[model samples]
Target: MTENPGFLLTVLAFVLVIGPLVFVHELGHYIAGRIFGVKAETFSIGFGGTIAGWHDKRGTHWKLGWLPLGGYVRFAGDMGAASQPTAEWLALPPEERAKTFQAKPLWQRSIIVAAGAIVNFLFAILILGSFAYLEGVPRTPPVIAMVAEGSAADRAGMKEGDRILSISGRSIGDFEDIYRIVRFSPIEPMQIAIDRGGNRLSVDVTPGVLVERDRFGNEYRMGQLGIGKPPAVYDDIGLLEAPLVGAERTWGIVRLMVDTLGQVVTGRRSVKELGGPLKIAQVSGEAAMMGWESLIGFIALVSINLGFINLLPVPMLDGGHLFFYAIEAIRRKPVPVEAQEWAYRGGFALLVSLMLLVTFNDLTSFGLWQKLGGLIG
Candidate 1:
């Protein structure tokens, strides 16, 4: 496809990636609501004007809309994100509001909110594990897969299949460990210990810095060695074992995110790494071009991210709702309605502001404004 069409295709691809994750997320809420006997008025994807939908026997309106950004599951008496505690809620004759979310027990509310995120995570894990079993899990053996022509490793006479035992003085357990060291300390010259056919060799190779795009269109400067595997061996496992593997992989990514954020907080990692929808769109398009496997892998990662982010203790999010539930559980009463309203407003503002900033970053990263300026000039 032409580049212009590619952009459109990319948009569709992103929707594909995002839509299913969101559906799975909202499905969790839907399921939980049904289980708890909470009334659900609408189950909609996208927001705003409903383009198409249907009414189920249970009176739930399942619809799709023109906008494709995100979706929501509206429970009975949502009162919107910034729900008010009007006399109507209190004067609901008790029995009526009992079916509403606001009237649910603290534990039930927590479960309903927490379910969405949990489902996203579960979906990611299952996808990952299935891929692992199908593809025989690619593993790097702490060995050099290839050396870029005329690159540092080539200059140092590094050969393929040379097992990397150590970098500087630190031991290397896996090829990934070496990658982490190189990316984290790109500029530093390091000593390497290699194992070649039962022979030990030592050399020094300075990793070169290069810009790489992650699955989410975010660009990062990291050490590049210009090497990768053709296809590594995978530890075979049965169907029953795949799901656990997937869950473990999902957890690994979660741990990496936590670690990266910790590093960012400590000023060791850059905030520029933070990406938004634009980045996701760019990456989604790129992944589509790469192949189905790559796209699926990217989707899984994004799904995991969505799950983890929603679990954050920010207002208007599943985690944030759960936070209030926790307080209710502890205090034996809900936090004041005024406090919840203000908290949601603040959270919504923060979310919108962050989106704007990330979009700006995306525009800059893509040189969109620069190209436009050149056209004007």
Candidate 2:
């Protein structure tokens, strides 16, 4: 039987993308732990059986697992990848206990737990900043060059040469800002503040909903104002300023993610849009085919997502650990072990359910069920 070259490329691309990101994330935790005088017992770049491994001079057992889905850093006295405290760890003598993660001050522990996501965000910023430095930043003005007839902007009495000042009270700096605001806001009403002929005017416009498909045939629902802009102008970014640009871009992505999740929660967007590992693998492969630049950009985007997701207040995640730490701070003591265990179990279940949902969406997006039906027919 011949192997599919495309499938092979997809698998390789997925591994290449995920492995480094995972390593960066865990390295964040490991570094933070080391800084606080805590020892990492094991640093594995995947879960389950070890494919390759070694011990550092510090005695941290570093290993590469067969499964490349995710990775973890197990600190001394930590029970598992989730970093649950162990009975043996708790029972350790004062000297030994001081070297464990749980023995750290609340603030230090919080920083240590939150370090992975922070590093992910920083990694994305570095990549994005490099791109900005090399390629320059878009300096497009927010002037409307064209408005489709009888469309949302036209209906709202907007005209060509009108410079958009703000959308929903958020100031717009460039033409790209308009698209960013409109894209996730399908059919949503927004207040548009524009300066026409040097006179400021405010108009309420409901964006027209558009269903667009990508080259991969994946569908996206977007809001369009039926407005167009002139060609974008690129300005060379200085070395120092490029990082600021990258930070701004990263924050913009974070805000967009928040808006997306809000839309999903409010029933404005479908949950089916959520994707999982398979979707990532497909996209990674596609990006690889597009070139190194595209693949690198995709990695940065995913890195931001990873950082954002890990910060959510869910158990078995970094955020969940921070949540417990927050409670510990308030109560002046840790949460009861039994309560913590139950909460962890619930969090684990919630995560598993979400994983299944996203996986199902991925399969559906790939037409897996349709192909199966065809085979049966």
Report lDDT (CA) for all predictions.
Answer: 0.81, 0.90
lDDT tens digits by residue: candidate 2, 72-118: 99888766545557778878899989999878888988999899999
Worst 10 residues of 2 by lDDT: 1-10
**Candidate 1 lDDT tens digits, 1-377:** 22332678789899989889889999999999889988899998888898999999989999998888789999887675644455667778677688887777768877888999999989998899898788765465887778789877888889899999998777776676677667755545789999999999999887777887654445568876666644555567789988987997798678667766776777766666677888898788888887899899999999999999999999978888888878878898778888988999999998898788878877888789899999999
Give candidate 1's error at residue 232 in angstroms. Answer: 3.9
Which segments of candidate 1 are over 4 A away from where they belong?
1-5, 80-85, 91-95, 138-208, 212-219, 223-231, 375-377
Model 1 poorest ten-residue lDDT run? 1-10
Among all candidates shown, the one with the greatest TM-score = 2
Question: Which residue pairs of candidate 2 clash?
Answer: none
**Number of clashes in every candidate structure?**
0, 0
- Per-residue error at 240 for model 2, in Å? 0.5
